[model samples]
Target: MRQNTTPRGLVQAALAMTLVGTLTAVSAAIARYPVYGGQAVRYAVAAVILLAVARFGDRSRASRPRPRLTVREWSLVAALAATGLAGFNVCVVEGTRYTTPAMIGTVVGAVPVLLAVVAPLMERRRPAPRLVVAAMIVTLGATAANGLGGGSLQGLLLALGALAGEMAFSLLAVPLLPKLGPMRVSAYSAAAATPMLLVVGLLVDGTAVVRIPTAGEAAGFAYLVIVVTVGAFLLWYDALGRIGADRAGLFAGLIPVSAVATTMVLGLGRPSAAELVGALLVGCGVAAGLGRRVRRPAPVIAVTPGRESVRVAEASRP
Candidate 1:
């Protein structure tokens, strides 16, 4: 079934994700300074910011004006938050330890592809052939950009897992949109995931959390909280709500392209001609695939608050 699609909202969401990816890559570079895990540091910081927002952003909603969730709904939301938000963050950070930032970014870029596959599976449908092709091209480009020569097996593995984490997040989050609005969904997810992450961070990093970070690390942590965590989540869920999860995911492929470019611009490293070509091809391929949006019928559930979920639209899938 097709849905009432919103082009402008989708574009804005894509732009937000792209910005998050770029900023995340740069922050990773900055995190390299303190010998603490950039991924862990950024996430821990992000959790704090998210909690603050969740607490203070909407005091009216704080008491939960909506009806209380059934036990099942709470469990589902917790699982979704744990795997999608929490799991993705942890894996990406841990993956960076074993992989190059470029490699991590590239693999992370493939999240759209993963979402394409996973979304269809969740909906009990088959994905389009063009999406499959786009995903493959993006994968090949990611492999090339990550210096896929020899002796990089560990990085490759970690990168792949990171991609999986991202896809898992996207797939799990889609169904939750209609149940919990984007703000509450994200806030609750982040808040729920915070405790577990804190425990993990304490166990893994030890006293590092209390230790003062260098100027650069502090800046990186702040950027991650402001940009990647807060900005990215808002845009991501907003996109999911506007378009179906599948189309929204298509734009995710731009992440690695942005990350690699950002890295090169910062003089950390330059992509070889081959890598550059790969990045562009991946970016273009994903965009081209997404550009083929066919108007479809609206979902059975109302995504917007106080509005009916179903809408009159065409009869093709994304």
Candidate 2:
């Protein structure tokens, strides 16, 4: 109502998760592709697209000077690329060998709680109790949505690594976002991640790395490059800067819900009652975490001619 960016931030966060969640299924299209090699391509393509859009397409942004990165900031971007981008894509793909996707998703679902706890601590403040509790609720909702599927010990570890990457994706960017902004951060991180992923692809696939993709794999990579990499990164990082990591983190719960919804849309399966309840809980948790408040008019005091105060029935809204 007052030019508040929080609502916009919330919407962006939701949209980002939607892209990520819906694309979760689409990723299987490229399952046969070399994992590291495919991701390297995706990141490289996305970085170019982002850089072009950020630098050339936005004329309004031309006047604003871009910030140069300090050494520490460069280090952070490197770590973010390595762990959050390269490591996450590799482990998440590899993890499926040891367990069900639901189990891995269930473990990775803890990102909300992780961000809610760690983000505030990074700022030298105690975590907000309400936000923390809401994060827990969202985590529970995600777990329910994922059906609490079972996994092997190694799968559990891999899922934990994915969780760390997801957490780092936001927390590390918290420092960089204010300086570089979302577009630059997205652009730079994607560029940085390409080399790392390509190296891994080379090591893993040897001379066979970076083969020509099939039609379906090409389509899948296009979707990832345009939506999940370019669009989701900008949306999430911008939201994180606006509403902060704690609040934005709650939207991570939507990943599983959106995945379920996508399955339904694709006629793959119907959602169970637990998933319905989980979606409801996710909505409730996000609403509560955002501090949705209602206001009422307070009783007012009136001054009579004698300057004495008299009780009045109503007052304007505060």
Taking every candidate in turn, the Cα RMSD to the unseen true structure, in Å, is: 7.2, 5.1
Residues 1-318 of candidate 2: C-alpha lDDT, one tens digit per residue: 111335788899999998899886797789899888888899999999988887774576777776788999999999999888988877887788898888988889899888888898998989988889999999999989988777799988888888888888888888888788899899999999999988988888987778899999999899999999999999999898888888889999999999999889988889999999999988888888888645668887776887666758787675
TM-score of each: 0.75, 0.87
For each candidate in the order shown, give its overall lDDT on alpha carbons: 0.66, 0.87
Residue 214's lDDT within candidate 2 is: 95
* Candidate with maximal lDDT: 2
Clashing pairs in 2: none
Per-residue lDDT for 108 in model 2? 90
TM-score of 1: 0.75
